[model samples]
Target: MTQLPPRFEISRQDIARVVAVFYERIRGHPGLGPVFAAHVDDWPSHEAKVTDFWANAILHERSYDGNPVEVHRRAGNVRPGMFDTWLALFDHVLAREVTPQQAQAWSALAHRIGRTVRAGVVDQAKGPGGVPILR
Candidate 1:
C-alpha cells in the first residue's frame, strides 16, 4: 500500500532532522543559546519533544502535547523582539536542511507560529486584563 503524503509537502524525517540541527545551533547561539540553556537541562529530550511538535504541525501526527504560548509567556525571558531572531535562524536552518519548496512552506508556518507566540508573550506582559501598559 502507498503511504499517505505528509502535510505541507514536507517529510517527517526531514522535520526531525531540521529540528535537531536548529536546536544544535540554538545551543551555541550567542543570544538564543543562553536563553535556552537557562530553561533546557536535557538537550536530547528537548530535541525529541520539538521533533514531535514539528511532526504534529507538519505531519498531522498529533504526537505533541505542549502549549508553546503559555510556556513562552511564563518564561519571563521570552521577548517579542526575540521572535525575529528566532525566525531568521530557523529560516537559515530550513534552507540548508531541506528542499527550497519545503523550506519556503515550513518557514512560512514557523513565522506564523512565532508571531502567535510573540503576541502571547506580549499579551501576558499587559498591565491588567490584557490591557496595554501606559506611561
Candidate 2:
C-alpha cells in the first residue's frame, strides 16, 4: 500500500514569521509595494489576518475562515500583472524561510489560490453591473 506524506500543522510562530518576512519583502518590492500601501490601512490587523490565512491554508486547521478572494477583490483594483509579481515574491520568501518540501507545497497551494481568485474576480468584473468579489 502507498503511504501518504506526514500531516503537519504550521505553528503560530511559523505563520508570524512567514507573514513578517513576506510583508518586509512587500515593503521593498517595487511591484507590490504601492498596491499594498494603498490598500492596506491597518498594518497590524492586516498582518494578523494574513498570518491566520496562511496558517489555515497550509495547516488545514481552519484557523481562518475569511475569503481571501473576496477580500482581494474588494480591497481595490488588482491589475492582472500583479499576480505574477506576487508569485515571484512568494517564491523568494519560500526559498529564504522554508524547507524545500515546505516551499514546494506552499508554492503549489499559492498558485492554486491565486488561480481561483483570479478566475473568480475576472468573471465578476466581466459581468454587467457585478461587483468584483474580494476575499
Off by over 4 Å in 2: 1-9, 127-135
lDDT by residue for model 2 (1-135), tens: 554332444566876888889898898887788888998889888888888887766665566878877877786677555777788888889888877877787888888888887775666564346764333
Stretch of 10 with least lDDT, candidate 1: 126-135
TM-score of 1: 0.88
TM-score of each: 0.88, 0.80
For model 1, which pairs clash? none
Q: Write the per-residue lDDT of candidate 1 for residues 1-135, one digit (tens) a residue.
A: 564456677677777899899999998899899999989999889988999998988887878999999998788787677888899999999999998988998998898888888888877667657675321
Report the error of model 2 at residue 128, Å: 11
The whole-model lDDT of each prediction reads: 0.85, 0.76
